[model samples]
Target: MDMEERVVGEVLVVRPVGKRIDASGSADFKGKMVDRINRGRNLIVLDLSDVDFIDSSGLGAIVSMLKTLGKKGELRIGGLKETVDSLFRLTRMDRVFRIHPSAEEAVLALAAAKSMAKAPA
Candidate 1:
C-alpha cells in the first residue's frame, strides 16, 4: 500500500492511495503507523478517502495503532467511504475512533481539541 503524507500544522495527514486495506496490506499499514508514532508523529489524521474496502485485519491493525498511541497521541479517522463507514458502524469501531469528513476537518478538530485542553478552566 502506497501512502502519501503531509503536515497540517502539527498534525500529520496520511492518505493511503489504495482501494483496499485487507490482510495483505494491513501489516504494512500497521508497521508504517507504528514507525510514525515511534518517531514522534503524535497528532495524526488517517485519510481514507481512497479506501473503499477494509477487512477485519485492517480494522484490527487500526485498533492496534490506536493502542500504540495510548495516552500519548491520537489517531483520527477521516474521509471514510460508504462501505468502510458502514463497516465501522457495524463493528462499533466508529465510536472508538474520532471520525471526520475530511483530513482538513480532522486537523482543525484536533487543533481545537488541543487548544481546549490547554485552556485555563
Candidate 2:
C-alpha cells in the first residue's frame, strides 16, 4: 500500500492509496499516522474513499492509531463504502469514531466543533 499526506493548516489529510489496508500495509500506515501525531499534528482526516476493502487487520491498525492519537487529537474517517461502513457499525466502532462524508467535510466538522467549544455557552 502507498500513502500520501498533505497538511491543510492545522488539518492533516492522510490518503492511503491501495486496494486493501490489511496486514501487509496496515503497519506502515499506522506508523506514519503515529509519527504525525507525535509531531503535534492533532486533527487527522483519513480519506478512505479509495479503500473499498478492509479486513480485521486493517480495522485493528486503525483502532491502534486512534489510541495513539488519544484525546488531545482525533482521527476522523471519511468516505466509507457500504461494506466498510457496515463493518464499523457491526464492530460497534461507529460510535467510537467520528465519520464524515468526505475529507473536506471532516475538516470542516472539526473546525466547527472547535469553534463551538471555544465559544461562550
Candidate 2: where is the Cα deviation over 4 Å?
A: none
Error of 2 at 4 (Å): 1.7
Q: Once model 2 is optimally superposed onto the true structure by TM-score, how far is the C-alpha of residue 101 displaced, in angstroms?
A: 1.3
Query: Which parts of model 1 are misplaced by more than 4 Å?
Result: none
TM match of model 1 to true structure: 0.96
Predicted candidate 2 versus true structure: per-residue lDDT over 1-121, tens digit per residue:
6887888767889888897998888888778878888999988899998998888889998999889988888788888888898989989999999999988898889877777877998
lDDT of each: 0.92, 0.86
Whole-model lDDT, model 1: 0.92
TM-score of 2: 0.92
Give the C-alpha miss distance for residue 46 in model 2, angstroms. 0.6
